[model samples]
Target chain A: MSYHTLQHLTVRLLFDEKFVKFVYEDPDSALLGLDLSKEEKAQLLAIDSRAWSYDSLRRLRTMRSLVEEFKASTTLVLAETRQLAFLDKFFSSPQFHDSIQKRGSMGLAFAEYLSEKFRQKELKTPQLADVLRLESLMARCRREFQKIRVTPLPKTLKDDLRIKFVPGADVGAFQANTVLTIQKIEKYLFEVNLMPAMVLCDDAPRLMDLPAVETKKKSYLMCVPAANGVSLIDIEKSDYLVLIEARSSLTIHQAIERAMASGITKSIAQEIIARALEEQTLHLV
Target chain B: MTKFFDKIAKIPRLGVGISGEFGSANKGIEACLLQENYPELVHFFEYGGDLDRGLDEHVRRWASTGLPTTYHFLDINIEERIDLTSDWLVETIEMAKEINATWLCGDAGRWHFGRRERGHQMLMPPILCMDSVLESVDNIRQIQEQSALCCLPENPPSVVYLGEMHILEYFAEIAERADCGILLDCAHLAIFQHSRNLAPLTGFDNFPFERVIEMHIAGGVLKETNGYQYIDDDHSPEPLESTWQILKYVIERAKNLRAIVYECEHNAAEECLDNFIKLNEMFPCKIETPKLTVK
Candidate 1:
């Protein structure tokens, strides 16, 4: 794929007055209110579920509560779903702008939804149904906030295996503990501040450099995780909180072996990354 | 006294100074230019968004374009990322060194810890302070201990904001005592005049004249915000008349004014440098040079 191809045109045709009017008129209904074939409807539902799963199930619950509380209009809900669909298509498409831009547009849409809802709350004049629509629209916007592109840093920095691995033989031994530690760090960051500085990516290293976790130095610990990798993050360069699911445990090992990974070093980087990520995520959440 | 006169006298032959302290830098240089004090021009290039070239490339581009001396302000997004450990800091300083910048001016990036980390010794200037005058002097002292390059308080006192005069005096004394020369930004002193309540700088004429070694001049705007519109050096326009007057006053008083920089944002406003030329025509001072012809 061409590196500079323009993808994520969410904002490109977004200013169209007619389409906007249609969204306002009936959000829950499909765009144009045309009947969907059974297969198309199923596909749309599948896409919706896929998006919900991408972030977490908690957001779905939030949306349900908002729908109930606001008695939202079908139009606002439909508008939001369409917005989500647009985002999903944009991210999943071959034409992803760098992940950061994707993240920004998604964030903007969500903010707009919330801002609109907040505006609705202050109004003494809007009908109950319109208020509901506003709430539904806001909820839909919130759901797709983290759809971002993942661009790797310069290869000179990323190519070294020394940069990717954590040390300790029992490192894989504490796989569950590692995951739990990451979660705790995330929680701590969120509690203190919404924006987490670190992002952990265990997924394909080729896809991301994982600036958050740094395992450069070696150390000792009581129990080491069976499988986990870490890198230390520099928050100023990359602004968003991060998470990575390494595709395989062996891949994690290879990274460690190449880096001469030590369990202690990994743990330290993990702890810092975890805190930074938590701070960032808390900000976003 | 010969050491002082020799330095001031040779300023026109060497590169002009490029100071990026908002208003004063531009005004000071303009005052020099108007008096026919044509020192080599120092352009303080402030990077804006969506520009393709990095710092080195920017310096090279301007140098190749025939500007005598080019310095960077290192402001904008770079300043916001004050965490010097970040690659941006490393790259920016490396660029400054590569370009042989006479001064690399900066403010603390947001979220800065205000500590110098090891492995960052190769960078230039080593100044860490921004915004506050007192903190700036302390940082300047700390940096001076590490390197010969001068550390500048990002903006000098405005003749307009009298609240700033004492702090400015404090900094002037420090600079004098430290034996470090001043990057007297002309625009900031002009901002002092725009504010009515602050005491004008008439009585404080003897403030730190020996410390000044460089001058800056640039154009800016007069905009209204919060029901008050005032001149700000962030944008470029014709030099403020009051700013030019004050700069002329500085040239006559200071015995050690070395280089004068005509600092402006790249493509800041339509007539930024032209204003510098026009102001030069109006006053006609000592340094020798022809009006800058823009063909």
Candidate 2:
């Protein structure tokens, strides 16, 4: 129990590069106020000076995983600026680091951090906020889907089958057309076959030549866990209403009725329900 | 001797180990399963998963085959009292039961600093002192009691170790106080000895070999940075000579040893076959026929 402080300090040494250097320079001064024992203090001082390089390697590993998790957002950030300044600022923030320590999804936490920056007008990129939001929702949906024991879909949506929105399925409204913007980003990434190594080395070709996206129209998209990855489906306000009603376990007929009560035409409600089942966004139980 | 000794003796030899996202990536056991001769090579799976991530489809598929499995956790910090929450224990036991795990095992190291998160995850060796050992003992005992399964504490790999006690002595004291089994990861021990400039078998003279229920053999890469040379546990097919030396020293001494896992999940089947043949030559399976097979 008493060694918790030692454990805490050691973790900081491994992760916080600045602190590692401070400790490496003057161990006694850096660890002055801690309640560690004399032997523990000696142990702390004995840490290899080369730990900074190890920590650098660890940070690279983290970046590699983050690239995989937030592909679209990372692609946009890199493509727009051709530099890692945005990422550097985000990774260095104490708030983001605290989120990582708290076991939060790195994608979701980064999305939240970017949203804050956008709110404060810190970000000038027109479509960056919407792109990050889209990726964050997809990441959340994927995580929620992973935690559930998914039941196999029936051959067809039967009248007797109970239907509900897949656990963690969510909808978002964005100022920019995220679906089209992501499609362009994916195509750009595919054409270049961007590798983390290239990005790390600053050898990646400048992508600033890409055309700016239109950011005036409001776009509605639903993110759901798909068979391979997350699926972002373009939808109308009517479809969103139907999906919201389907969140609770209900028969297809009941969902349609609720949608109709919400001012969605019965035929439109039926059509959206049928399409949701086909996309596997709404599951039969 | 405790009941865990007999329980672990039932585990088959020549198992395969995988951790992290190896299962999801279709590496580790998946690669081995693709081989036509895997039935002769792999007897059981040491399914290592983070409790937060749960098991993936590949692990579930392996479990569906009714193969023997042992759950190796990657999330818990057994040395930190705050990390041993009741909720964590419940979730861990649930995951172990889901895979029908034979027992539970993980490295007795600081898995994370404050909370068990992906960013904070690491494999630093415990501060090798009596207080750390006592704390770890209490935690291991709690895990064993809560899960009703034998808990084996593994010695974590580290480039730099701290404290007056040797790594072997630290784990030996925990095994005695907790009344549990031990998982002797030879590669990790090799790394520790090389870091301290000690012989491979320097500290084994007083170790509780009989308490060792499992042994791990993993490939490591030797690299030097800033005038410090250390073995990195990269899980390649070619294990260091020091690892093999440690394994050879303990093979006969570990009286209760039931498992010797080749942590070559990242290697291709052809690349691992040579080591598999070598391991089979050293410890032949007790059962004449393979217990698990892939279609």
Q: Which residue pairs collide in model 2, if any?
A: none
lDDT of 1 by residue, B64-170 (tens): 43333423433322221222233444454555555554444432211111122111111111111222333344445544444334544334322122122343454
Distance from true location, Cα of B253 in model 1, Å: 2.1
| lDDT, residue B90, model 2 | 87
Off by over 4 Å in 1: A1-285, B1-53, B56-58, B64-70, B76-90, B106-134, B142-147, B156-167, B177-179, B199-203, B264-274, B278-295
State the DockQ, from 0 to 1, for candidate 1. Answer: 0.02
Predictions' DockQ, in order: 0.02, 0.20
Global Cα lDDT for candidate 2: 0.75
After TM-score superposition, the amount by which residue B48's alpha carbon in candidate 2 deviates from its true location, in angstroms, is: 3.2
Could you say which candidate leads in lDDT? 2
What part of the reference interface contacts, as a 0 to 1 fraction, does candidate 1 reproduce?
A: 0.00
The deviation in Å at residue B217 for candidate 1 is 2.6
Error of 2 at B257 (Å): 1.6
Compute the lDDT of residue B264 as modeled in candidate 1: 53
Candidate 2, residue B24: Cα displacement in angstroms equals 9.1
